[model samples]
Target: MPRPKRPGEAQDVGAFPPAEAGITVVDWIDERTSLSPGIRWMLFRKVPKGINWAYTLGSATLFAFLAQAVTGVFLAMYYRPDAAGGAYESIRYITDDAFLGQFVRGMHKWGASVMIILIFLHMARVFFYGAYKYPRELTWIIGVVLLILTLVMGFTGYLLPFDQRAYWATIVGVNINGTGPFVGPFLSDFLRAGPEFGATTLSRFYAIHMLLVPGAIGALIGAHLYLVSKLGITAPPWLKAEPEPELLEHSEV
Candidate 1:
């Protein structure tokens, strides 16, 4: 007969059995790479108190971007970027034939809009709360650059379908770029791959959308996160007048 649990005795559920295994793997990698310290610093760092729901916008924006990146990669697998009439048809095939392609494509499309809105909201929150002042100026600047890159990502992706709407919108966009000052003509020429949109333009947009913009955004995100970790999240204005002690220790004097 099996022994029953006694009073006040705890039942073992075999929870966390893999915890030791996970630690072993982490230690093995940490030994080779010396990554534990950095990881701990990043994960265990403290931030300002009294942060409210507005603080979540930045993380939400990051999540939207990551989702867009994943969905974009899946989309690229079947997307044909040729300027010839195939681009629209390729999109149709993906939406109609590929498994779950419609859902992924829809997510990528809507995710871009969500990311843009969230980023704007985040910037507004920071600006209104005065987080852009003082020691966080560089962070704000990087965030602005990130915002610009994100907009450019949207613009570039807009033309990938190569439909009438995309063609006309890109034409208008190129013309608008040409209206700028010193580098305007050069910029327009580069974007159109000559005087007007063609196969080269499609290729260029694809390269920018899929490679250059994402790479730039990724680098800026890394820098942004590093600064956030180092500077700590800004305290809400209504909080205590004095900054946190740890924040003062890390701030520029």
Candidate 2:
């Protein structure tokens, strides 16, 4: 018969740890992909020390987008996106009963505008830096797609209040959709959820603005960040040359 093992001895083959004591799948994942390692993996890898204020816009834009999403969630709790006293009464409740509702709404509105501007600035910085070349091409393409989605989110958000502006804007939008060949009417029906804008239309836009668009934005951001990590930062052309001291000495000699 096999001898009994000591307290600190290793278990025999085919033995397993107790269920409650065993490591979890999450533990395995954390061990393999811990971002806590340092800044090198999280960010700042290969990024130049001279990165100017313009390079900061991407992070600022992302922060603004997150702030808008959180504020919109709060606003959604108090605002009714329907035709039954929705446009004016909802505004009254937000401005009256809901503490900081007006501020939240105002912040979301202005943040959207700021996010748009910052994203453009960020894109311009990347473009001028030639950051879209070769290995970073997919990130650039995803950024373009994200830009289109951002505009869509803004347009969809503009229709949520059910006011005259929302009504006429959606009407024009529906008309444009209805003008397309073949499935134009179908597309309009799908978007409007009927022949024209109504209570249902308001609810649909609210859903898209609050849920669908944000979800897509989140997914695109993930893809963009993943591509950036995969490619790493591209060094400037000048930085890619021999060291400054070597070049200087060679020129002097």
Q: Which one wins on TM-score?
A: 1
Every candidate's lDDT: 0.91, 0.80
**Model 1 global lDDT (CA atoms, 0 to 1):** 0.91
Model 2 C-alpha lDDT per residue in residues 34-144, reported as the tens digit of each score: 744544565756665545677677789889889988998888778887677665678777877788887888898889999999999989889988989887888999899
Model 2: lDDT of residue 21: 36
Clashing pairs in 2: none
Per-residue CA lDDT of model 1 for 1-253, tens digit only, reads 2246699988554543666778879889989999889989998988777988999998999999999999999899999887777889999898899999899999998888999999999999999999998899999999999999999999999999888899899999989999999999999999988976766899899999999999999999999989989898888888878777999999997
Worst 10 residues of 2 by lDDT: 13-22
Q: Candidate 2, after superposition: displacement of residue 190 in Å?
A: 1.1
